[model samples]
Target: MSFEHEKQVCNLFHNSMEIIGRRWTGAILVSLMDGPKRFNEFHNMIPEISSRLLTERLKEIEDYGLVTRTVLSDRPIQVIYALTEKGAELQPILQLIGNWAARWDSKPNIEENTTEKVLNI
Candidate 1:
């Protein structure tokens, strides 16, 4: 490939990782991959996430054009979160990551509630 094209590709990959690497963003995208989910449903799905962080992640994804939030005209103004077309396209990538995780999952060396650290072998 040409130098300019290579640089462009690298930049796009860098930007994509920077955006997706944020806390809960990747999880939220993966959760919404199947279809729309309500706010409470997301909370239940990802029990570890705090409300503030959840709200922040949702807004961030929405701002990134990957998520579409629909407000239902119901008694309580229900909100549903769904992936946009671009977001849906990320399914393959997520699956690949999941596949890689499965490879290491069987030999997980980290204990629960422990901060991650690399073992220099």
Candidate 2:
């Protein structure tokens, strides 16, 4: 491959990692795969994350065009966060990562989680 091609590939890879490699970012993305969620719903999905941090991460992805924040008009305005097409594209990537980790990651207690329980079959 040409040097220019290699350089572009490397740049793309690092850029992708910089966004997705942030702590809790991948988990947050994974949590959104099923459908839209509210702020509290995200917190429930990732209980370890602080509300402030979750807000920050959501804003970051939204800026990246990966997530969309929609405010609904109601008695009390409700805000919903959903993955954009770009964000939805991460689902398969996450699944591949999970499959790889399941094979090689050394966390034996992983099976204690609910997903592992269901995946055990």
C-alpha TM-scores of all predictions: 0.82, 0.88
lDDT per residue for candidate 2 within 29-104, as digits (tens), equals 8888888998998878789999899989999999988899999998589999999999999877877776767777
Local accuracy by lDDT, each model: 0.79, 0.83
RMSD of 2: 2.5
Cα deviation of 28 in candidate 1 (Å)? 0.7
For candidate 1, write residues 11-108 as lDDT tens digits: 99999988788887877887787679999988776889999999998998899889999999999899999999988888787767665565566666
State the number of backbone clashes in model 1: 0
RMSD, every candidate, angstroms? 6.8, 2.5
* TM-score for candidate 2: 0.88
Model 2 scores what on Cα lDDT? Answer: 0.83
lDDT of 1: 0.79
